[model samples]
Target: MELLSAVPFVGGALGAIVPFLVVLGIVVFVHEYGHYIVGRWCGIDAEVFSVGFGPKLVGWTDRRGTHWQIAALPLGGYVRFVGDMDPASAGKADDGDLTPEQRKHAFHNARLWRRAATVAAGPMFNFILSFVIFAALALAVGRASNAPVIGELRPELAGQVDLRPGDRILAVAGQPVETFGEIIAAFVRANGAEVEVEVERDGEKLAVPVSYRLASRIDYVNPGMPASRAGLVAGDVIVAIDGQPVASFYDLQLVTAAKPAGQEIVIDVTRDGELMTFRFMPDMVERPHPVTGETQPLPTIGIRAIGLGGIDPTLEPRGLGEALESGFAQTTRIVTGTINYVGDLIFANADPGQLGGPIRIAQISGEKAEEGLMSFVYLIAIISTSIGLLNLFPIPVLDGGHLMFYAAEALRGRPVGNAAIRVGTMIGLSLVLLLMVFATYNDLARL
Candidate 1:
């Protein structure tokens, strides 16, 4: 319902909220379900399995007597096991008064390995989800590969431009490029300005003038988005933003990103050789940073750019087996990239603004949805991996922190002093709260 709302009031963010909530709900349900199911297998009785926190909304008691419910706020979820003093699953003190049967099924009474396994299951599930999703995407969508070479061109446009199959694109708008990605990037940097493309054909390079073509043009437009609402059409060539000439699609990004959200700006475009000028406010949007996994705000006109002069394929699409292989490799790259970025942030080599919280996640989820179902599913895997990695941080109030305590217990050959755990819990909660506040602040600033 929230996502169904009209465009965001100030930043046009209202629609994003729904997709964000959907993503959060799925992840939370998967996480808490892990804890609940694992505890049950370990002979620990769970009192409730809850999605979200705060006031309860709808629920039903299962056959095993565990209350399953959806709460009003869908931010996070939890599983409350028997002998737990609170919803956080902290152990109940001095369980000697409990009946033998109740004590037998109590979480605190479980073996050390069992307790550890139960706690670790949540993050473990997240990792598995990531792998599964990645594999599925690879199977469904062909693995990305190869350089930009025109293997084919649309029949109509093939006559308009001097392009042909087997021509390897070497540069766009005079920007040297090798791979398809670089070619796309070059086009983006051109925005809407007419340019030239150099290609290698028959061992000889030729420069083709695309003076009548655009560097970047709209390919997709979501209804109610800034561009669509402002009367911008797909295929429109953006010539300028705020009177400054745009040379590349990336120019649009630079021009808008530097401007504050909700700020009004003039845009000049030529559609079918008819030049037009329009004034509209750029919407402030929060999205995940590509490298850092942090949330940052950027201005958007709500348009996706398409390849301008056309494209040629140099490599064949990979088969399912190859796709699966590449998919796993891709996920690994994401993991390593995120870890490296986080390290850079900690060492003061990177900006702290690279850290984003729920808002950032939500924004990306919505944008991905607009891209297509495949993209949205891919985002799910990425988010799942992020959750798994975050939970593994050895801080209190998280699975990793609990594992740390269990490690101490294993070394000491006995359970830790309740006093120490209580202290650690407090410290962990404080650190977690601090992170939330900081991320929230960043989100607000971006909006």
Candidate 2:
């Protein structure tokens, strides 16, 4: 693996494609299995359960006569049930010689509710998988405590400050702080200057003067972005931009924004106690506002701060219930945020160019994997949630579309006409294909 990184294109492709396949395969399998299991419970016999499309690479028939297979393509998967015309199960099979007993297990012959439930199960399982992953991650990492306590100081702060882990911060400068937010606000007010911090350490209160402007230290480097392309990495503290000293992350942001787009700028950073300089042109792109979901053109070097006031938060022990609750909230937030973004895009309030495809996802997966296992897992949870929510959109050729047909059947006392279903499916397929093409174009443009 180390040697592979020395190769030009081969190294990057391997790094990205492997992680991408792993994430996609797991998500697709979970989704398809959802349909398979639910269809089985509904007395429907699955003829084939596949984790991909195209030619079969490997397969085995189970005792129930269901062929479980992995296919050549890894993009998506499907469950072909009995009485399905094809793998997509878009239509019923015309097998005249089928026994009545066999017909009873046919998916198309199943009750309307059963079919709907089976279709809905795919997206449902995706959401559940995301929730489980998020909850597990929270349990593993623990949650940040509410108090303004020091968990661990940044390594750069070593010897410069006497703050220790488990120390409860009482005040910054002269302002007393009761919560973590207050502590951050106090530091921000200090404007990156050295301030006296009062802390309760080992049952004794002590005042320690410390510089609270470590937010300039990069916590994340966005893959394929200006900073990453220029060889900037996390833990590198950006000290100056274009010869102007930057004392905080906010200052760095200001300098970047003030610089003209596409203009080459010099960035001085300190990494492992050594100063280094990098020159790069910042990208001007339409990015979604963090709070509003509205698009605005912004100049960014693509570095991120992981925490407020440069504090490495101490993780507080979390119970199972709390972890699950946090997971639910996180999943809910992503769903709503995505919905808002889609709505904005449709209304021309958001940037459609920001829509990404497989390539972008692969790049992100590779970058996060390089960061750490937990970061990669977190990305998986996010992508899983997105996939689940997307499948729920009421469009043809999706889980939502099938549900729409079921609703019509329930309302009209019969299934929608075959002709109408075929047309809808065609339109849905076209839309899906167009979307993929457009998103891929965007990905290439980014590159």
Candidate 3:
């Protein structure tokens, strides 16, 4: 009976493994199958369609003679074309002298355009997967909770500007504002210009004049800090610090940092169309150096300053076209943000702790999946989008690399030489190995 009871626990554990593996396998299979299908369509012979990598664990051969196999590693899969020297090769030529019939089926014998099509299909499938998933999610879930609208305005600023909570901004400085993001971006870019602000409030459109004020100081509180304990959040613009007028977040930070620890400070904030005040004492936090056994004192206020702005809620939900466009726009923003964040870390401008690897992704996937089906679907969409974007990067072993080679071939009227291919392959292989090592190290460090 005890052994029977344990079966449920064992089954549950096995069930957990199945979903992760299944999802990963499906994604990789779709990517590789893209190449296989396109290659066959172009009349090029594909020798193998294998899932995962490393040593083969299971195998089967189809009537067409394509060897299908499941490998030990579950990371990714690939399709091997006949006459291809290596995965990265453009299949410039078949080194072994073969019969005329065999030569016709060789990858190198295929027209340049066909070969390019085969290589490009992998990333193309990834993008198609992303778009379809996004469209389906949007159609099923409807739009995300409508973009935040102007909830409240600071009394000091309110007196100067006639805008109120629930006012929908139509445009700023003559630029059309379709979403809340556009409105805030326009406001910041205007930077105190005598800009014309058009808004819709209570079904009435109103035009108002507003100027941007140069930000002086910005205060960012660490998460779980005393400020958060006092109900302070990231977007709360501190209009007053310690009952003193503050121009920017910096001014608030400077004053709070200069104040003695445990001194109670009053902070005034405009949030979601309401004015609120909070009293809190800054806690002294210690930062210890890893190399040196030394510590530094820093103010602890748990919260990060993203930006200060009121969102206009009067904007209506977008149509299908607009929603799809917004999805693409969001994807672009995510890619740019990721690159910029990575650049920041490389230059020591940002914390390295933010970097994560496969383990982190898996943990996030599990957590998000546990939240609900919608959350899990959203995670899949994001991963698909990221995979698409990453494959588009101009790395030699990636799909983009093949496209690069094709472009060169088109320009030069011939394929790149074997020597060039060999060098590029070596460089690409080295880069991939190095990145995997770095990612694994980062993952382990977090653990």
Candidate 4:
């Protein structure tokens, strides 16, 4: 902590890089292991299992003669199968010099199905890793209880509310609510106005007045946004903006939205009972719509809503089966959303600036690590799912590209020619490098 304070930029860089390496390293290892194990199962021996590319930083040859190594670069990894010209398996190695036993166990000599499975396994394993982590998280966090009972409330209240913890919410705005969802709907119907909340307390039913909108407590702060740059963090309560008193998050949003981009504004916040002031010029930012993937430019100091209106719901522990189901659903949602965003990018409907590369990922990783262990782990699952999906894109030099070749071979009943394979590999490598450069540019622009 002292070192970070002494040299802020250097410390921040280290913080970001360490977590990024940990996350990418784990994902890459899992992906490569999937290829190695499946290849071995299909009578194809691996010559090397590398966690990165370029010269070996550290390595050891196992009993099976597979050189397991961590290479100099930390960007990506590969599994080099026996009788492969390179780690990418773009062409065949010299098999004439191999012993009879070695020749039979060569990857190129394996059955077509075996080869396809080996290439596909890398992505498949990535999905499996994400699934397991998501499932475990679901199990750990459990599910929110359906009953309309307030388990807890935020320590700081923006305004007076008659509602209290342990109150069993019976109705909202004179409308009976059987579940929490209905209560939320009733609040929405109130539309940022005060509403009557009927609650049962100490065996007595009573009416309490509550605000429809939540207090202006920061729930989430985007890492590179104006709020974060100005040193605002989650849990800080916005007390006022430009000397105008602010109560609800809605008010904060409305004020921020109305301010012109680059207009300087003062924000007063309460953190741990101490009032602090911040001044910054909020920038106009573009982000993809949650459901649409189209770019939407919104004016703001970036902060996300808490979504619960200052009330905490009760949570119920989930069984393994239920947890797994939730995990699968969550993973599927991420995969679909990513695909949609990519589709939008291809159609030019999305902002290219939103496309992040390693630097952006590193920034996020560091931020999440600071948030807590669970947040960091959850990020890992998300990145794992993304890596798995990315490798499945039909681009040469990727797992999906290999599978594409295998499919073509299946159709033609002959392997793709070495010359064609080499050309495709070169094109794929160029595309990947270009993409990295573009994404890095985006990251630098944000900085």
> If scored against the real structure, what TM-score would every candidate get?
0.68, 0.79, 0.56, 0.77
What ranges in model 4 sit over 4 Å off?
A: 1-12, 156-164, 185-196, 204-212, 215-218, 221-304
What's the CA RMSD for each of the models?
A: 9.7, 7.7, 14.4, 8.2
Instruction: List the candidates ranked by lDDT, beginning with the highest.
Output: 4, 2, 1, 3
Candidate 1, backbone clash total: 12
lDDT of 4: 0.76
Model 3 Cα lDDT, one tens digit per residue, 186-283: 66556556799998889988899987553532233332234533445444666787688877544554566566754566778776667677765555
Find the 10 residues in a row with the least total lDDT in model 4: 1-10
Q: CA lDDT of 382 in candidate 4?
A: 84
Over the stretch 188-228, how does candidate 1's per-residue lDDT look in tens digits?
44444567989889999999864333355666554334565
Looking at model 2, the pairs that clash are none
Best by the TM-score measure? 2
lDDT of 4 at 116: 90
Q: lDDT score, residue 188, model 4?
A: 45
For model 4, how does the per-residue alpha-carbon lDDT over 255-332 read when each residue is reduced to its tens digit? Answer: 776676546778999999999887665656564332233457656667866636666677889999998998898788
